[model samples]
Target: MPKTTPTPGVVITRSTLHKAQELAALSYGSVWTGPSGEESSGEAVARHLEATAALLATNGWDRIWTPPTPAQLAEADAAATTETMLRQLLDYIREEERSASGRLTAGDALNRVARTADGDPDTGRIAGDVLDLVVVALTGHPSARFGYWSERLNRTFADITALLTAGALFARTYGPAPERAA
Candidate 1:
């Protein structure tokens, strides 16, 4: 008979497994050892299973995992564009409507603008430009308004994209793996 290939899995050392298990258990609150190191909480085997992914990650098992492709990076850039625009627009609108009465009206308008922009980057850009007019009308201070826009723009969308992309990749890559046989 042909030798069967072992079922695919990360080969981690026993110590790494122990440490990862401990950290994972702590994070999930499954086996919470009290501050005194005396008391402990109930164990949920199901929740404990949720910890396996983190175990794999911490063990250097995923070093061979594929890096983000160019297409994915481009997608992140597009998403970042829309996200950054929406955040800046929201902040600027809030800044322009500082008074209580204006805030009430601004709240409604802000919701409408958000709905209108939805996920489209172009619509976000347009909404932001229109909101800029409102800000200019509300606050006639040219220097202050320019300063705010400058600061907002300085927060590069690429940074936001990179952070979000990394988080998403981690979540996707670190899902629970099959249990080790006893």
Candidate 2:
């Protein structure tokens, strides 16, 4: 009998060392808790991989990408807005702390946001953001540095993931049968 080809499934593109540099920067910055001098490109890569592995181990999500339901998307949208407002508040507090006590704890800002928010603190979006960051760090390609990396990477990946996720959701919601092939 003739040999048959197996169906093509998900294709994961591995990160090249050059590509990994950018990812390392983004991922390391995302979870960095060490002193200023502690982070290097190589160290960032290690931290990125470690943090991603830990999240995967804890979450037990076998699939790399899952389409979000309409409700989940709405929740994520709300969470994103909250996160933006919180970041602005945190920045202002940091400046105030610099001029006053010369020290500020993130807990203070986070607690204040939660306390002041009028409605539900839609924290579920944080999980989605975290997952998106992990995915980008795990798969992103390196490029020329333009500006502040942490903010730039987060924004860049957020937009990218949103587009990709929307496509996935569209397919899942209205696409043809999975059995049909090109």
Candidate 3:
């Protein structure tokens, strides 16, 4: 294959490492606190994930992504309005926290889905946006970052667990399907 020339007026994206360096600068510069005093770096990433999710939500990310299911991974092809789907997710979070036992906490559900969300990017990104909402929506509950991980992996896995938990939350809403009768 021959090297291709760039199109005029179009910009190429920076390398992932470069992009990460930029975000890392922003991530560390940020400061957030709760009743417990300063948040952990991972906790700060949780807040950043929440803000990033909110920005994506406002820009119509949800409308473009389908809910996860037994049949498919999430795709940027949802038919529902972003607001409608986000509302349902919010309502579902409320329902789960209000009464659903052993199944509502992102901090824990993240454990399994996190267990599984290892190699897929799309599934992970959608799940990140979704879990940020869930953990934050649940309120008073510790985020997976703060609740489940230690300092060494805090910031890195905070991002990972957020995505995994979001995927888990959406899966809870839409899939894994009913068990077949034995």
Model 3 agreement with the true structure over 1-182: per-residue lDDT tens digits:
32223222222122322332333234433222222333223322333334444433343221112333332223333787898777776776666555422322333332333334231223333344334333333222223332332122222433434443343433343322224200
**C-alpha positional error of residue 20 in candidate 2 after TM-score superposition, expressed in Å:** 5.6
- TM-score for all models, in order of appearance: 0.18, 0.20, 0.20
Per-residue alpha-carbon lDDT of candidate 2 for residues 14-39, written as tens digits (9 for 90 to 100): 23222333443455443222233231
Give lDDT per model, in order: 0.29, 0.31, 0.34
Better of 1 and 2 by TM-score: 2
Model 3: residues with Cα > 4 Å off, grouped in runs: 1-118, 140-169, 175-182
* Full-model lDDT, candidate 3: 0.34
Ranking by lDDT: 3, 2, 1
Model 1: per-residue lDDT, tens digit, 122-165?
22222233223222332333222212431242323232222222
In order, how many clashes per candidate?
A: 0, 0, 3
RMSD of 1: 25.0
